[model samples]
Target: MKLVKVLCALVLVLMLGQQTVFAAAPAPTPAKANEHSSTMKVTFYSDSLHKEMQLNVYLPPNYDAQEKYPVLYVLHSYKLNEDHWFDTLKMKEQADALIASKKITPMIIVAPRIENSFGVNSSKELGYEEGSGNPGDPGVLNKGMYEDYITKDVITYIDTHFKTIQSRNSRYIGGTSMGGFAALHIGLSNPLLFSKVGGHAPALFVGDMWAPLKNLVYPTDEIRKHNDPLLLAASQKLNKQSIYLDCGDQDDFIAATKQLDKVLKMKKTKSYEFHVIEGGHHDDAYWSSQMENYLMFYGATDHH
Candidate 1:
């Protein structure tokens, strides 16, 4: 009987030891797929333009509405709709990767469709001149007032509907090509609205003739001075906000962008950064490659 009791005790000891070992093992980290980021197609009425505007919003992985996140407004290139940023660039995937790795602070991305309005309140007609008119081409038609729609209407909608840090410091704006131009123009025009503005391969206007298509936008020298990014930078109209400008070496806008850089340098603006990346061009591959750089710049900080 004593021998039998000893064997049973040994079994209990072994069982307890195994239980301790199992309890000490750490749990595996959650997979990124389990917390995959999500995209929502949202449409809201814009009182500014007197119409409903479509927007694509990206919520970071494992997003919780109770938690507030900073917002980055990324404008699409002219003629391209809001989906171009996410569809062509795979921006949500990139954003998820950065956020999951903690390379960038988790934030929301908002891409609003502007109907090729150049992101401006061009003339009284308010909207882009579609049909027959190419981007940067003259003889265009006006449809709606987009600048107010984006800055005033869309922003208001996001702030009211989502848990967003609705402050200039938490707000960032960026785009490629004409969207870049719009970013520079709108971002600079409202200094108190955006903390950082990035222009990726911006289609900056050096003169009216540089882009015959832009005549449809600027239409006149006075309007050009007021709306053109180059002119705004030259005249030192840019507010005291962080400015980021980069263009491809092979991009046709390089010369004009360089001129803008020179003017910014001459103005002694120390809060701006300009780069001429090698083998870069005004194309999808080029923009896609720069997404990391753009996110790092925009998401570099978590505070104002």
Candidate 2:
């Protein structure tokens, strides 16, 4: 009987040990699935154009109606619609992951269609007139009222509808290629509106419009000098504002970006970040991979 009781006690000890081990095995890391369901198509009338523009808004997971989120305005490259930024760049998935991992704070992303205007503001309609002007010139279509669409119309619509933190520090703008150029131009021109700016493989320093077209209404040297980002940064008080610039090392515009970096440094702009990744002029893959880093930088600090 004594031997049997001792054996039973030993068995109980072993069973408890097994239970402890199972408990300590660490819960399986939750599956990293893309489970974003909050999405909507928002339409707002543009008072500037007296027309309606469509935009897609992506809200964070478990979003609460009482909470206000920072706004990220993403502009697309030429020939690409507003959906291109989210679909091609895979931004929705990336944003979900970053928010889940706490790498970046939850924010509202607004993407609007510029309709191939290249984010410019012009008085005439897009595209060239047949013999009346330079009919098939690629530069003619790039000149339009896209800048106003982004800065005035789209922004106004977002502010009036969404529960966004309406302040420069809570707003960020990002884009790629031609859209990248627009981001830089608009961000610098209206510093009171956006406190953060980023560009991927941006077409910076595109020289004068004359180089791209013969009859283009190029800005005068004085106006061009005022609008130049590198030049503008020198005089502007970019307090609490940040800039991120990235481009592929093998990109054709790498040299231009490098020049911009040099100018930033010369002006002692300490708030700027520049990166040259190893790759070519690739598309979504490149932007998707770098999106997290840029978004984190944009939302890292609580300027409010």
Q: What are the RMSD figures for all models against the true structure?
A: 6.0, 9.3
Clashes of each: 7, 1
Error of 2 at 131 (Å): 8.9
Give TM per candidate.
0.81, 0.77
lDDT of 2 by residue, 85-129 (tens): 777888888788877777778889988876545465644454442
Scanning candidate 1 in windows of ten residues, the lowest lDDT window is 134-143
Q: Model 2 misses residue 15 by how many Å? A: 47
Clashing pairs in 1: 126-144, 127-143, 127-144, 129-141, 136-213, 136-214, 137-213
C-alpha lDDT of residue 224 in model 1: 76
**Candidate 1 global TM-score:** 0.81
Per-residue lDDT tens digits for candidate 1, residues 191-278, read 7889889999987766445343554567677877767887777775454678899999999899999987887776544278999999
lDDT measured at residue 52 in model 1 versus the true structure, 0 to 100: 74
Return the TM-score for candidate 2, rounded to 2 decimals: 0.77
Cα lDDT for residue 185, model 2?
69
* Regions of candidate 2 where Cα sits further than 4 Å from its true position: 1-37, 124-143, 206-219, 268-270, 301-304
